[model samples]
Target chain A: MNKLSRVLGVVRNQLATYVPRINATTQAAVAPTADPKVPAPAKDKHEGLMEFFDVKENWTTNEVRVGRSWRKEELRIKSNQDLHKLWYVLLKERNMLLTMQHEMNEKWEPFQSPERIDKVHESMVNLEEVVRERNRAYYLLETGETGERPGRVETNKVGMHYFFKASEHVVPPEHNNHWFKKFGCNRREVAKFRLYYNEKIWLGRLKEKNRNTRHVMKLYKRFPDLDEEALQAEYPDVNLERVKRWNGAQGHFMPRNL
Target chain B: MSTRWYPIYQRGNPQLRVFLPNFWMKLVRPEHKQPENIVRFITPTQMSDHDIKQYLEKIYKVEVASVKSKIKEGLIKRQRFRGYIIKEPDYREAMITLPPGQTFKFPDISTEKEKRDDDEIKKFQDAASQSFDKFKEMNKDRPGVPGWFSV
Candidate 1:
């Protein structure tokens, strides 16, 4: 209790010292308005709906210089409340930039610094990623789950597999007759399609392997003195000895001593 | 984020709250003349009239009397050579009415820019004319000669 009272006393003394400073700052702000010789502040007192547009000075300029987007590392250090506020600030900036671009397009004028939109978009993406990372960490610590939307790889009627994102529903899958009727695909035709699709995929892989092997042989033929280790590293899947033995791998010059 | 996937709402569940709503609202010029107090905005299709009202009131601090919105169909055009049809994405437009005494005017942002461009064009034209005059003076003695024949 003694320590608590002492801490409270220190906070009270600090507040007493800070109160006059805050008052002085407010007084300084008001002093400018009282002086007739001094020019009014550059920023308007209230922007209202005009906040949708860029500053008046920028309207006529062909370039509006701006810094790069917020990095994920920078956003990670900020607290959740700061991130929340920054999200709105970025949102408002994106909206303003879009508005300016749209209006400029309508007026047949060039929108300056179009990359600003991309920068803001990149910042928003990084910010969201950081938020998601924190959320995932929190959920994992609390519930052993990522707390992200659930999805699964499911084969469609066309035998094409896709990630199906699951959403909340009033009824379970067994009770949802309509969903089952739409998504259920056990027909013989689908089975045949899947078979053909698998064959095509396998053929594609085979063709790609053959192409790589041929390319390696051509490289060997062109540059017999090429570093074997580099070639092997480039095409790890190709059998270097088998490719070296192929006729295509031979050059017009005499074979070098092994 | 505005494009983040959300779970479907079911009755008797806790109210869903968007702590960091990222929906964007662009103030657009009205297609037709509107009342002084009416402002037009293009927002995401997912936003309803109530959402538009609350967005302006809460985020922009604008007092909205009412809001009416409609989904505008995008234009469909065919490729010039290939003739493949392309349809632009549809957008939602909201017409917000401010309080009776309040009004907003969409300022003309291009006038100053147009004037500056005109000055630049004039300068370019003057420079081009002066250069042509100089070239003519240089080639006065050799009429009908090609410009490439010059040293």
Candidate 2:
């Protein structure tokens, strides 16, 4: 509680220092904070409505500069509403970058520093996680349970069992035969797979064994005084002491004085 | 991570909606001649036929009569030094038939007729301005040399 208050205080101080210096012209455009009892100042209804893939701005510029993601600590101090606004901002940035990247590919022009798009994406994902954390906290405070996402387990299309996470659906499982058939899998194919899968595993093991043997041979071939203790620790499966006494671990070019 | 997984539904469910769907669909021109209502897409390999239906219906606001997807094997080549065969990942192409009346044609982005003329004009103007700037900067240092001489 004390830490939360301290963080909140720091954020309050930063808000006082920064918000006042913001351009006065821009201040009037943003809606002012009202009573908590009254619902959030009705946001522009068009705000979050599928603006990401809008086809308006196609050909504009070559290079784009973007800022770093908001850090966890920085986001933790923010109110839920501000965080939501920031999410939209990041979302818009991502959409713009993606559109530009798609256009660049279509134009066959080299996308300059494509990692900028990825960075924006990463930032958006992090911001989402931070918001989810705060939402969970708020729900816990209000309703006494973490409103974190839920998950479940189910079989795959191949009869292979896997976790099918719990999520809401447009149609209930009882009614949705399409979904039920979708979840079911081919069991005979899975059996045929298991046989080949074991063979592949055995082949991998054999290759791994050869690799280890060759590695040990190469190690001792180079070094006359290979540390046995260290070698044992490194290759616990191989009998290092026995391998050292064997002729395979010996150098061919020169006789060791030791 | 999957698009096909439809979960169990209950009353007053929060609309099992995805806030930010990571699915990407590229609107590509069809190769062969097709009906005006049909559109083609080179979508992600992981995208199912159902996903294509949902993407068009929900995002594009286009009614899809049917969606058929096929995986086209990528080009294969012999590696330069290793002498080993390398095959690229198979990309899925979805051919979706729109209900009716809707026609999508790839816009001609580059105006080919004016391109060469515009380039030639721009080049000549740039050359002229550069020469003018050089002429202006030339007469600053030399005593008797012409204005075009070394500055």
- Measured against the native two-chain assembly using Cα atoms, what DockQ does each of the candidate structures obtain, in the order listed? 0.32, 0.09
- Identify the leading candidate in terms of DockQ: 1
Error of 1 at A34 (Å): 15
CAPRI class assigned to model 2: incorrect
Deviation of model 1 at A30, angstroms: 11
Q: What is the interface RMSD of candidate 2, in Å?
A: 9.3
Give the per-residue lDDT of model 2 (tens digit) for A107-172: 666555577666656766666777667667777899897665566676566544577667766778
Native-structure RMSD, model 2: 11.7
**Predicted complex 2: DockQ:** 0.09
Local accuracy of candidate 1 as per-residue lDDT tens digits, B30-141: 9999888888999989899888888888776778889999999888999999999999888999998888777788878999899888898999999999999999999999
Candidate 1, which segments miss by more than 4 Å at Cα?
A1-47, A207-258, B1-5, B78-86, B118-151
Q: TM-scores for all candidates?
A: 0.71, 0.48
Q: Tens digits of per-residue lDDT for model 2 on B1-151?
A: 1123445667777667654455666656578998766667766798899887886666434678899999888879999998999998677889987656545554433333235447778999999999978776765565467654443
Clashing pairs in 1: none
